[model samples]
Target chain A: MASGIAFGVVYLVYQPFNAWITEVFKGPALPVTIVTFIFCIVVSLLTPPSTHTEEERVALVMAERNQEKTASVR
Target chain B: MVSGQYAVLFVIGFFVYIGLMILIAYMTSKKGTTQGEDYLMGGRNVGLLLLICTAAATAVGTGTSVGATANGFRDGWLGAVYPLANAIGLVTVAFCFSHVRKHKFRTLCEELQFYYDGSPYMRKFMSVVIFIVSIVWVGSAINGGANYLAYLIGMDMIPAKIITVLAFGVYVFVGGYMAVVWTDAIQAVLLFGGFVTIAILAIPAAGGFDNIRAAYEAAGNPGAMTAFGVGSKGVLGVLAVALASYYGAMAGPTAHMRVYTAKSPQTARKAILIAAAVVGCFSILPAIVGMSGFTIASNTGAESVLANPDFTFAYMATTVFPPAIGLVCLIAGLSAIMSSADSDAIAGVTTFLTDVYALIFKKPVEDKDIPKYSRIILVIMLVGAFGMTIFANDIMSYINNVIGSFTPGMAVALLVGRFWKRTT
Candidate 1:
């Protein structure tokens, strides 16, 4: 959330690039929309997925096994 | 061309919208049994598409089209930048989603009460304050509906206001959150269709790039072409607008609550990210509309553009489009107004009845009771909101003031609760 808030604060300083791009395209409908759409697709891909990994799963199983083995000894 | 036809069409459109809402309410609801969670949060099964659609629809409302456009017309692109600020706030909410959802809390007020258990009294006080703030916010939304109906139908504002409040209140009271969400989904589509169509047509209406450039020069605001405008005043002024927009976004309770109501942290994150992208696009509509008005009215003596910036979108639609398209746009505006109002009202009432009442009364409230009492509370609050709207001045300004006063404190506290070491 702070990252998003910070983004807003920083955008004020960096928005010249957005304006420049808009002006560069000179208001053509297709290019701007297509470019923005593709950028969004890339960003979506870049966003970190929340699922866990196989190594982490193995570590958790090993920890469980160790706990059970200790419990049996106790 | 006649006044009666507009009124008749509006009435027909209103009923059609209500019928669709009723159908949604009856269809989506689980068979003969719904708990508080089901009614308020849609059983937490909201998929990525539904969540994104609802968020985008809720954010892109009549206020954005009307007030944002007016602000854009008066102040240039800076005003339109507020939606971007809101997108940033939503992204922030997305980051906090996992923490809040994993805890399994039902509402933000509940989260507040839990976090502030150090002072139970403070929790109650803040809960009441949150309730009042939401009421005030929803009240202004109700007024937006009335204001639009009055303008579109050429009726007195009071009658339109009453009709709007009553219409939304009935649909919401009967249907519950299922109704509100699905209705919002439909309304969002309408709003998107109207605005996108207008924007596409407006590219030409703006006379393409050359005409826009010529218009900017004619308006004697070269900075309007560049990123830095004369209004920057200093670093503080530049930051102030950005901060204000960001603050406004954070202050919005409706979007904040959606994070909790979503089915999963992943779904919520995806929704927020999608909303950011879609709302970013929708944000440009008002700028386009306002600029189109600025361009077309340059020679047409249409001072309404300047006199009431709030009416710029409507003015552009009615003046530029065919009668059918214009009416569709009007209905679209009404969709924006009612969707926001109804959803906010449902959320406000649910918070009050379930969160506030349960906390104060010291009872384990059953899920079965929430839908009924929530509807009752919704009516009572809508009545109170209606009274306020009739007497309130400048709905947008009032909303901004409400956000400015309350949002900073809430944001600071919530941020601390989520990220600070002490809480964890």
Candidate 2:
């Protein structure tokens, strides 16, 4: 979700910014790279850390499998 | 049109590349076990480098290379928005869904099934959707490659497409996902190198960057020099295309398989980041080449490639570089198509076997039978894709319409299912 929002923000800004840079500054790459870097940083900051650890994920998978097996038996 | 000598070089180069891909497939097939998991997902142990290359290659296919360059020829910088958006979307996938790599799901539908409390309905629906999408994707890839082959070698479109499809199908049928990955890695290099070489050679041939801009201005299309260009579809259109391209990269079955096949979540995440950077850089090259082609045509009083922008890359390939380098560019364009075709073929077959056939019939194939069944399914899917190509007259528009219509719904479903606690 954060990534999606970040992409939206970047898309909204980048188009006009890219045009301005290309027309006035005659440089597209510098502005694009800068905007991309900023967008990535913002997205990384906004995205919450992973909720489940590796062990928790494995345990969850196992539990789901066991539940499926029980349901099938029923 | 390409000269006879260059056509010969292109054919030789193409066949040699195909032979190497087949050899790689054969070698990989011999070393691996023939289990369904191994064939379909590379045993879910793909490393970072291979993942990066395969994902990048799959995303940066004929659409981004030849198609985008052609658009650039007509629309200028606006033509690059699709790939630029794709690169951003890839990074978004890494940031948002890298943890999916930890799961052992074989197809996107399997993930959907798990999210929907094991309900098979969503799986069935998504399976059919992805299957059709993958087949269409394969056809588009063939269509793009055939255009290059037809233009470069003067072969008719159908025969060129047949040969292109067959070349990729043989390798995928023989080696499965592993072959696809290894070949994608090689093709990624060829694609990147080919485009970069053309862009470099084209600058001088078009009489430098300044001259190209001057010519574009002189042609009474000064807006083409701007970032938005004359073709900058309104803000909503831009956003829609961006989102569609993003969804295509993130939620599409081929890309979903890439996530599933990664060795680990961290590996997938890292690979996505690297691939995003590579794709972002590679996306601009086609635009550069296309813009150069436009400039060349304007300056030389040659026939405009604008009448069919899809031929812009091919026009430049034949006209801008030496015969040897031009041959490499043709092969690179072919590689772009093959890389996508092979990946989509594997994804389509995997979806059919696991999500559609297995779930609908409740009949799982034995491990010993996987390789044979996979080959059979791959062939059927390729043939089906080929048949569809006959009806798909405009490759880019067809792809865009399908993706634009379907992806937003898929993206919403994926986001809701993944993060919304009440989705089920």
Candidate 3:
């Protein structure tokens, strides 16, 4: 949801921002760079940090492997 | 027509390149056993550099080189929009989904299964969709490569397509993902070096930037000098294509699969950022080269190549440089096509072996059998792609339609599932 919203905002702002930057700065890089930076910042802030960690992921895999082993034994 | 000497150089250069790739595959395969996981996912132990190379190589396809330059020739600076969008999308992926590297997911279907709370139906559906997308992607790459070959060497398109598909397929069949990544790294370098050299050379040949600008203005297309290319699609249309292309690629099966091979989440993030920077810089080259082509065409009354923008890159390479050097540029463009084709071929086969075959049989493939099965599947996919190429008349339109229809929804799903807890 947050990602979708951030994408929406970037999409909305990019055109006008692009036009303004082209008009003022007379270059394509500055406008794209600025807008991309803004978009990344927005997305980073809005999206939640991942809850799954390496240790937990490893444990999950181990547990599944063990279950598979036991089932095969049966 | 390519001079006989140039054509011989092209043939030798192409064959030698393909032979080197196969040799790499042979050498790499000898280092380890070809278990399915090892073959398909690089043993899930890819370091940062290889990750960056494979990701960038896969992302910057023939479209970025040939098609992008073509668009630049036709639309001026507006041609940069697609690559710019792709760079932003890569950055977004790095920020939003880098953590995916921590998980042991293999295919987008597996990711979708997790996102949808272990729903088998979602996995099945996505597997089919991604598989189809992979096929189309492979076909498009082959089509692009063959077109370049036809234009450069004056070979018939059908034989060129066959040779293109077969050349890449041999390496992947022999070495699998390892071959794909290692060759991708080489191709990425070739691709960037070739295009940048062309851009640099073409600028002076086209009579400098001022002449190119004057030529564009004189062409009398509205917004020719502007960034958005006459605003034909308006702001919304441009934004839509940009966003759609970027996010769709992010959500693509090949892109997602790269995350699984990263050694660490941080490595994946860094690799994606590197790829973004590379792509962002590369986005301008094609437009510049194309615009230069436009200028030359205008001055020399060579409007036929201008009429068909697809030929701009090849035409410029042949015209602006000496025969020997132009052949190098053509090979570099061919590298762009091969890099993407090999990656998609692997992705398609992986999806088939993991998603379709495993699901149908209700059993995971044994490690010992993975390489054999993967090789068989790779050949089948190549044959399918070759068949599809017969009908692929317009490469860009086919690619755009596929990306437009599939990528946005997948991107949304991937984002929502990764960040939101209640996605299911």
**Could you list the chain B TM-scores for each candidate?**
0.89, 0.94, 0.95
The Cα local distance difference test for each model comes to 0.62, 0.74, 0.75
Tell me the spans in candidate 2 whose CA falls farther than 4 Å from its real position.
A1-74, B228-232, B391-400
Q: TM-score per candidate, in order?
A: 0.78, 0.83, 0.84
Judging by lDDT, tell me the better candidate of 1 and 3: 3
As for DockQ, the candidate ahead, 1 or 3, is 3
- Model 1 agreement with the true structure over B106-214: per-residue lDDT tens digits: 5566555444322234345556766776677677877677766666667688888777787667667666776677778888889889888877887687678577657
Looking at candidate 2 chain A, the ten consecutive residues that score lowest on lDDT are A65-74
**Candidate 1 segments exceeding 4 Å error:** A1-74, B1-11, B29-36, B114-122, B228-238, B391-402
Per-residue C-alpha lDDT of model 2 across residues B43-115, encoded as one tens digit per residue: 8889999999998998888767877887677767766777887788788778877787766777888776655
Clashes of each: 1, 0, 0
- DockQ score of the complex predicted as candidate 3: 0.05
Error of 1 at B5 (Å): 4.6
Q: What is the TM-score of candidate 1?
A: 0.78
Please rank every candidate by lDDT, starting with the best: 3, 2, 1
Candidate that would win on DockQ: 3
Q: Please tell me the TM-score of chain A for candidate 3.
A: 0.38
By how many angstroms RMSD does model 1 differ from the true structure?
11.1
Question: What ordering of candidates by TM-score runs from best to worst?
Answer: 3, 2, 1
